[model samples]
Target: MTGYLPVVGAAMSITEYDQHRDWILEKQRDLELQDFITADVLNGNWEHLAEEVLAKLDGYTGRLGIHGPFWNLDISAADPEIRQIVQKRLDQGLDVCRKLKATHMVVHSPYTTWDQHNLDQYDQGHSFKLQCIQENLGAVVAKAEDIGCTLMIENIEDVDPSIRVELVKSFNSNAIAVSLDTGHAYYAHGSTGAPPVDYYVKAAGPLLQHVHLQDADGYADRHWAIGDGTLQWPALFNALQKYTNHPRLILELANNANLPKSMRYLSEQGLAQ
Candidate 1:
């Protein structure tokens, strides 16, 4: 796998997709749609939006997915009512996936820095959290399986990298898998005393089915272009070679205009296309 340039792609909003339509369609690169991540889009009548997107993507053929709604929606909430809302939001995301024929949806991880420190203090604490997650996502997972979409649990505020890997494994379903966010992992490393970004790739191994490739300073989720931050792109790409999963490496940047710069940085380093 030495000198391997993995299949790289972009996670773009509908407008961004249109802006880069020619380049994306020319390369036939993989894509993760980001329009449905907002609450307004989820709560509104989005069928027309979906139809418009389908129309725009008429000639494109590539691996397609979407960033699911994760705003203030906790999939591991202890309260049944909160969990119901979370489930409803996720079900809506799946409906979008079904409409677009997407095969993956990126979801936020439930683990936190507090869970890293306190989950072991009580014997039931860890089990109870797992129970809550299972209860909340059981139906959603089944729907994902039925619709041929894998729900990728992405790391956010997670100090322990393996926590998400274990959580994904606990589901025992193919529809659930791990998703790594480079900026989020770097934040944990610099701000929370966790391991570096590459360790996360190693930890998730084959379970990592998707990735949000962003560069950051380890202070916040900067979502900058690949060379604009302090992350070790070479090391992370080196670690990625150990897995056979060939995960979807989607550039999830803050500014869609910087997509070319990001890809240029990776290509110059011989890391990705």
Candidate 2:
């Protein structure tokens, strides 16, 4: 805390954001709007939602981002038809970002535990996956670049962290970067035999630009408050100090009411302001 006071942010829906708008605007904390992560919202009258967000967020100044549509949309689909659908969904998400003036969008990683065990079993297996990613997301990445949005690839069931780092690097664009979800990493550590959460920070290093700072019991993605779970916050912060990128540490809790409790815990621990 002496050398750096990490900026703490939160991920919430429009309703939740409005409920806590006072606290959020008072501090001008970085925010990741979660309302654009589903198909229903993406297909519905999202323009109205954008207008509402813009009106509510008026006079507030902080880093704004959104959780892009990810449900049932795989960015590495091998089928051309499926890839087109995926591309459409993601492009729709970018449209939301464009309307909201969001600078970042969280996207789920395509790598899974199965890929870790079997990706190298065949010749050019990993390379083929990369090709599929390029085919599916090439245009989307270009669009993101135009809209001044960075796509953060978040780990879900990934066991090998370096695999995503490699994927982010493959695009070779500033709009593509790494996003670490703490609870997911902890689940991978305890349930999927992945390395500890701190290892993920070290692995991503400077490429890491966003973080979902939820707590878990190392068994599942609990999304609990900070002190309520078994994650090592100090170790995670220590590892984060190695890079000067100052990644956005967002508290992506399941219950937004517990945001105050989580902030209190981090403040008490001196991990974040």
Candidate 3:
């Protein structure tokens, strides 16, 4: 785990099961990847497609992970009923993970209408609203564990690290963990290296399950090629390597985390195994 880095996998091509089956399997073996990532919807033959891919990987003993659906999912909803609906959407990916025997489920904790950026707009009930949001997220964590799958909280650039840290602390579930993103973390802070990736790594160390690797201009998520921009891969890897579990790296390049470009960049940078 320390010496050799794992090959990265792509999100399913075009959300189709049949089209991606052969390619995913081939990538798994050819690239020596135990981890395959997908942002595929839970419906529309996703399960069957996953089965086909898993069957192929079963030959090579590959592990699977999923990027849960993002549309309309509100894990931090202030309303209890709305939060339940969001939980169902997230559970879809977890359920599929069970069928495919996926090792982890990567998820996004995105913005709500009452975005924290607009905190000044809050009236007298701001404190109460924030409490509701936290409680619902905690509940989601419990529900994720009940279903017997790991829920990796995806990182976002704009949200405060304290929010993520608090969620991890309060959720306190074995199934709950983090899906750190290098680019997102970089852009999340207002200034370059203001809150270093190393800081978040240590804070979320216990919940660290996997990672999304990319580079950006520190203002937007450009998803640049490795080392093409300013992302510090060597230092990032150095910090990550200090951890006990060798977290799988997902080369989250543009469109999809394609293996071809990922391999090329890593090879050029002497990062390929």
lDDT of each: 0.91, 0.92, 0.61
Superposed model 2: Cα runs more than 4 Å off: none
Task: Say which prediction, candidate 2 or candidate 3, comes out ahead on TM-score.
Answer: 2
- Of candidate 2, the 10-residue stretch with the lowest lDDT total is 1-10
TM-score winner, 1 or 2? 2
Residues 22-81, candidate 3, lDDT per residue (tens digit)?
A: 555664522112123323445466666666666655554544566766666656577668
Per-model TM-score, in order, reads 0.97, 0.98, 0.74
Summarize candidate 1's per-residue lDDT along 12-52 as a digit string, tens digits.
88877778987788778889998898879989988899998
| Residue-pair clash count for candidate 3 | 1
User: How accurate locally is residue 16 in candidate 2, as Cα lDDT from 0 to 100?
Assistant: 78
Mark the regions of model 3 whose C-alpha exceeds 4 Å error after superposition.
Answer: 1-46, 111-140, 190-194, 255-258, 267-272
Kindly report which residue stretches of model 1 are placed more than 4 angstroms away from their true locations once superposed: 1-3
Question: What is the C-alpha lDDT profile of model 2 across 1-273, one tens digit per residue?
Answer: 557888798999877777888878877899999988878888899899999999888887999999999888888899989988899899999999999999999999998889889989999999999999989989999999999999999999999888889999999999999999999999999999999999999999999999999999999999998999999999999999888999988999989889999999999988888
